[model samples]
Target chain A: MERLWNTHIIEVGFDKIVEFFYRMSEVADKLRQEGLYFRYGPERLPEIIRIPERGTLRVKYGFPIFQKYGVCMDVTNVEQALIAEEAGATSVMVLDKLPYDVRSSGGIARMASINRIREVMDNVTIPVMAKVRIGHYMEARILEALGIDMIDESEVLTPADEERHINKWLFKVPFVNGARNLGEALRRIYEGASMIRTKGEAGTGNVAEAVKHMRTLMNEVMVLTFMSPEDRMKKAREYGVPYELVDLVSHLRRLPVVNFAAGGIATPADAALMMWLGADGVFVGSGIFKSQDPHIRAEAIVLATSMWWSPDIVLEAQSMIDEAKSMMGIDIRKLKPEELLQVRGV
Target chain B: MKVGILAYQGGVDEHRYMVVEACKELSISCEVVNVVEKHSASNIDALIIPGGESTTILKLMKRFGVDEVIRKSIENGLPVMGTCAGAILLAKRVKDLKTGRVLQGTLETLDMLVIRNFYGRQRESFEIDLDIQVLGEKPFRGIFIRSPAIVEVGQGVEVMARYGESYVLVRQGKVFASTFHPELSGDTRLHKYFIEFVKR
Candidate 1:
């Protein structure tokens, strides 16, 4: 009764590159078995395909690590993780230093200790994610080896590379990258990120930056909906991503991967605001543990996030904790341009 | 017509968005039923169980006493649709993947047995196009994310759609269940179908 509908089809060109790699590796294995070297001369080598500096690519694997409306809390130890789990957090993001402490303490930030990560993973039934320095493939590999559920190539950590970021397509574990704009999101997607988080000036507790970033990304997507195919192709060329991916964004009217809001989210209201703005969820870092009532705040954020559509539920969540006992708000404007975590990658 | 989406837990937003889109297309009224305790069969023309963690949803459903209410309402001819984890809760029997332990608390509205995560874990999740007869010649892209699979179907249950012989979408009178997420597919045909089903 129906003709073929082509409007919803999505073509991810990077998938072809991944398939090519698989083929090359298989061919190399065959050659090695015959005691031969299969080598392509520079002239015969496959032309290097250029990816747009900031275009979204199709994600290969999607492990539902976090449930919809679930909160992924940032924890530094097993106890906080367990607390988060008990409070209804779907997942926990293990970190060596909470963003607020990182800003105040000002030092070389790095990945959390493997031993601590293992302890947290051992205790929590929920998924455990950890952070690695941006562009640090080795750290990502180590996290993967330790069997981390997900890895955040975070801007919160001191970036390891200046020119390039970690190539996530090579890993078995999924990666979550932070973005402040559509181009940055697209570029990270091209790099094979399974999840995207708004890098909203971490440790601020203001929620303004998170709102701005989310609106900016969504607005950019909204603009794409009205553009002509030729204009979209032109935009794709400008963004440096495959036209198919751009087209997919146009059709879906949202990012293909799970998009979360992070960086400055603090209260139940803050979490609810992000959900209303179309974030898949919210990541509370210094927000919960930094507050006076970690347990109540954690539980409240989870409830507020899940029942975001209800203002009465949000009000109840807000009433559960005191705002004065929460983490001191930092004016994002006061932070120098170099101190901003969102500006690290791209 | 007023459609109620069960909003106790997981993937609630996606369902709300898709259902709202479907309503707009059909020009019908819609509301998200968060307080399951307060929801009555008379007020809701139909209900949608959104995807999420089945265990958590089951526990909450029990706590709020929504489980008994929903099960009874469905028995009384209340139209309902369950997707992903929702499908597992709607099945007659649910078994744990590794422990082989049988867990129950499902609505048992659909006359079938489902194995949680039968296809595989989250990393193994995938999307495939399927030829659903009722939806016409256009194939529906089913998004399977750690979804359950129907292992057995009882009498009176009609298998409406499948992905390569695997039972993914099934219907039993007023009850509908799908192993994949049609809401996230950015296609409202399934939602439209449900709304049309409600109108009838």
Candidate 2:
């Protein structure tokens, strides 16, 4: 062991160690020039931030969705983002239009303006997520350059590509996409999505589709969990995702990524019910703003989400919202097949 | 045993998940307290300050009066465990690594002095297996994210663990602070250890 150690030390050589220090000193000198001071021994060594040179992204840079009952609110502007922060939202999804506005505006809903996203980023302390068109790589690039926390390749934002989704593996930050079933969820995971949300009917202010999607996804996962390896492989092939992802879902019996319920959550009870149905969290947009009191309703939704297991707390949360004042919720049955956002992405 | 997590800011979900998991393993009851206001801090056996951006957390804590409430609660025997940014807030003094300026809004609950971003910037953030003797022979995986380093400690402070030559975890009475995030480490030992500490 001692001989091997000496041989290892000799092979390492003093010159390489000196060269390492030389490069380190160069970096330190640059940092010194930058006016940043160091606290420990020697001079303040300016650190060279390690940038990944190659390989598949580790899904490290996205907003953390492992939060217990995280509340993700959809905000169109800075004021709403601030209100979300005040209301205990774990993160805010910045978009140009909520589903309500999208349904009513009847125009091509694209990514929110860069200036608007910037204003929200500057004013907020919590993680800020923005949406890009389903296949608009440039919009995702712009959001990435702006140092946005997460990007949603959303169908609600009008599909930028008809046949393909953004290659999420190409980006440094994480992408979240909506999935209507286990296959869609797994496909998105194979595409490098770090988080998944149910592609429920947006702006509808109803929770049926969200519930349906979550149920369908979970039930499918259970079936996959019980399948044989060959069967799972066949299912993976059928779903157009890798077998490894399918294997992971089989073992975990759930989506490998954080699964959240989004699109039509309108009340605190609606949020809690989604949580009880195995959703990691819920995302609300028109629900809070379209209510009698956004401040109270927002806080109530956040409360119900966090205390989902407790019926009494959920009841308390329910009492805070005025049911009559909620947004005019559109039933999923009324929506024509062409208007279904869930059917947009793969 | 009932434990509370300060959920108004920073890794609220991550910490709550880990702590709740810890409580489940330990077979104890736990509650996540969203410390958006002073009253929110009441009625918990212990409190956990999760990792996140320290300045923003401090600013929010002060704005919502959670800082004072936490101070009083800790004074009144509420055992607290602060990780990463939480450690910075608990320190008596926080120094900026860039300018060596004393940053404001610290709760001064812990006796140590900390230097922010001592582990470097976000890009330099990393994870490593640490030898914390208290956690037995197994190396504790410490996740350091824009983490600070505890450079100095008062006479009352006890060094719980270290990485290299710097102190990473320290305790002063019921107050425990760690410069690394245990919640993100996927290890339950630290949470279990903290829960045991809280139980005592």
Candidate 3:
């Protein structure tokens, strides 16, 4: 409480702080007039470029998807990518797993597999994403440096590293992580994962049981969140009632990405329902082509998922189903779900 | 009379568009060349280092073994005009962020600062009117896209234009630099100036 002020402290101290603020203000003003600031670093950009968003909505959404989606088509054929593309599958997953081998193999074999994926990318117009074994963030960066659009941080296969999966946030390129369940999805999202995919019990190729399993889980999920079909419609209705409230899409866009209904998508309706219940998209394995109606059902499922709410979209989807079925010699709609026992715990 | 546009990265397309149109009106050939890997020095009579990620493109240039090739080409006295970050790379001295001090990027190619992304960020990008001294009479339009500021310049650097206290344009013999992006503005005067410089 002593008030003796025969000191140089205020004059020396506050004056410099005041001068510092004034100089900062001047620098800011200069930047306003001059467009240049003091250096931060050379390796990083002083700014991002703001070009117009040129692509369509699907394309924009798909940009990060295919750029980073993992578990690529294990096949050598590039045309096989067309199946995923036409299904509006954002990307074809390239798995490094030895497709036939119960035993995974050598480094040269992995590189050869990668080269084959590169060939597929060259033949296609869309961006190509690649995979890195978990905890392999350095390798992921190398892939990005090679002009790869994305990386899949999937747990489906990693070379049994001693450490935890490499954190995706450390890399700049978009990364898609495999979410085995809802908890994992949220965990990865918290860990700065930009995208997520449901882990389909892959490679077994049993179509119907998988579809039913996913449907049951999605149904259970509807009860747990505000993303239920009825609730989403209700929210849309509430927004429409105000009609003047802006930022409907902006808010929707920020919701943690839940694209790709995973595990089991046995039928087209299941695909539509998944989209209805707030999934950003769906992943089908054994669901479409492996089903009895290989072509028609796949097209219908794709169409329904792509254009869930709009009837005009439904018709277009139907036509797509028709065309795909005729072209591929498989009526996808005719494929019935495979039956299986419900494990008591599952 | 085909003009080569260094298309390694950044706003290469914008400059390519500007130069190509300038060439079309002047009946000169202009091509956007991926100068990092795919070009020989003799492929074009003159070069325009377009505004862009200067470091990334320069990294590619070094990785692809073209940095010295470019330095030698500039030394041989080819007319070169660099805009924004492009201007920075073409400068004889640049602020090397690694050492927190100035270092040489070019072989005294342009006696200018060519500060990298002197502008703060994309939101800071803008267009401004300039009182350019070299154009000789009229006010010229300028677009600055994440442009670098010329904090200092050597004696050979001619301060060609000023926007308030900041030097917006500078020229040193065949080399010229502007902190603003003239290509993005769609103004032909800068291109015309470079063409005239090349002709001289």
Candidate 4:
């Protein structure tokens, strides 16, 4: 055994053998903790794994989408996806079941089927995004391999892990994550989320939670602007995010990434309200699909989001949809604690 | 001077911000307006077509009757600049890179042939620094997001920059177009150059 050890060390060198064993231990440790590890050859790891320079991913992915499309509509099939594109949506999010359906039919919600996503992608000329359950890195990988424009490590879908999230930095495709406040936004940005959206009570068709979350986030940012450097550092620690990010937020008076309001935005008025409250954009899920006229409602919401600053245009947009045709809203307060999707990833 | 940003869709704010910054640097008084309708399009001293979804912007422009106004303004020698999708709109010919067919309904102001999504999808988007003599000795960092590429330019068009064999920036008469977004780069040189053209 001693002779064999000496021969092996001589052939591969002590440093290389030690590194090999150390890497193997890491893999074993990861397997034990997470139940799986994507194995790649050591030489090719650097090329496969990427750490985005600060703000690069956001500039390349998030900013373009935010600037181009003030509204991202959710769709379940090829027809809805086409309607979304036709209605002038800048982007569309694909789902196996719309948020309303997810809320109605209680089950383990995962990423949409690959074929379904492909069908949507094939049908639409606009950018196609889809959601993967929180911490489901394998599903993220599949989406990335499928050439998805963006991935949402979303709370709308059932989380795969209770306490962890997919390390977004590992993927080439930009990710959008849901955050309820400044801390969550910064944390997701630190974790390499290129975009951040408010985690309102999705599928409820009630914009109150969405409004509350946006107000909280913006108000927190306002508070940060008044803090001293030392107080800011303390706040950063309290938020469990990097002080640098906190500093950036304080100086910029906004989240460094593109922030969109999502969850329970059901009407043109609701969409305009979020935009007026300072969302770069918005995401409508059940709001459009569950409405009386999905096509007209979608166009109205798009117009409202884009022209939120102009009251007359917003009024025009509001008149395009009928309130009676809107989705029946749920009182978020009535939902049990376990039924909340917003609290899942948080 | 008043500048109109074709604000129906896409990076409208970014261009407005950059143009304002450029004006400040040049000590020129400029008012930026969102050209949502025909009147706004007609009243501008200069126009900017921002980087966005070309089809969406085209649809909105036609819907609001801003497309004809813009076409007429350019015909009357209005200094205009377009980036990415904006560049696609200005091109005389636009070909879809995926389908290898001509895309119709662009403003067709600039004398160039642009291929849409020449660099593939979002995952294939990139950023790079280019040497443009017009912008002086410094390398301008170009942010390209699913950017188009200028495959051909007419006799009147002057190529300003190139990435590989394709033209990324071009100019003909008073029209300027770039396949990569200059507004996102936070560099004001391109904006300044266009401002100078407008000034002239």
Q: Pick the candidate with the highest DockQ.
A: 4
TM-score of each: 0.71, 0.72, 0.39, 0.87
- Each candidate: what lDDT? 0.76, 0.73, 0.49, 0.79
- Over 4 Å off, model 3: A1-346, B27-33, B96-107
Predicted model with the maximum lDDT: 4
Q: Let me know the TM-score candidate 1 reaches against the reference structure.
A: 0.71
Backbone collision count in every prediction? 5, 1, 27, 0
- Per-residue accuracy of model 1 over B95-173 as CA lDDT, tens digit each: 8564465766678778898987676544455566776899888877676766788978999999989876579999999
Q: How far is candidate 3 from the true structure (C-alpha RMSD, Å)?
A: 19.9
Q: State the lDDT of candidate 4 residue by residue for A1-346, as single tens digits.
A: 0110110011222122223323544554566458575532121222121232322442434344434346889999999988987787888999988898898899889999999999887767678899999999999999988888889999989899889887776677788999999888878876767778999999999998888898999889888989999999999999987676687677666665667889999998898788767787789999999988999999888888776767887899899999999999888888889999999886
lDDT of 3 by residue, B1-200 (tens): 65666644444544655666666676665554535443555566787776544443454456446677777777787777877666777776776332244534444577655554454332234445676766666667555544567877888788888765567788887777787767644457778778766756
TM-score (2 decimals) of chain A in model 2: 0.83
Off by over 4 Å in 4: A1-69, B99-103
**Per-residue CA lDDT of candidate 1, range A1-346, in tens?**
1111221122322233334334534565567569895332101122222221111121133344226567889999988987887787878899888999999999889999999998887666556799999999999989887877689999999999977888786675778899998888988877768788999989889899999998998888888989999999998998877786787777667776778889899999899888888787789999999999999899889878776767886898899989898999799889888888888997
lDDT of 3 at A40: 16
Q: Which ten residues in a row have the lowest lDDT in candidate 3 chain A?
A: A1-10
Itemize residue pairs with steric clashes in candidate 4.
none
- Candidate 2 local lDDT, A1-346, one digit each (tens): 0110110111222122223323434554667678884311112221231332211122232134333356788888889988987776867888877888898888799999898888887776556788999999999988877877678899898899988988776676668889999999878876667678898888898889998988888888888878989999999889987676687666655564567889799999999888878877778878887667888888888777766766876898899988888888888788888877778987
Tens-place lDDT per residue, model 3, A135-212, is 566667676565455566644343334355555544445566665444344445434455666555433333333344
TM-score of 3: 0.39
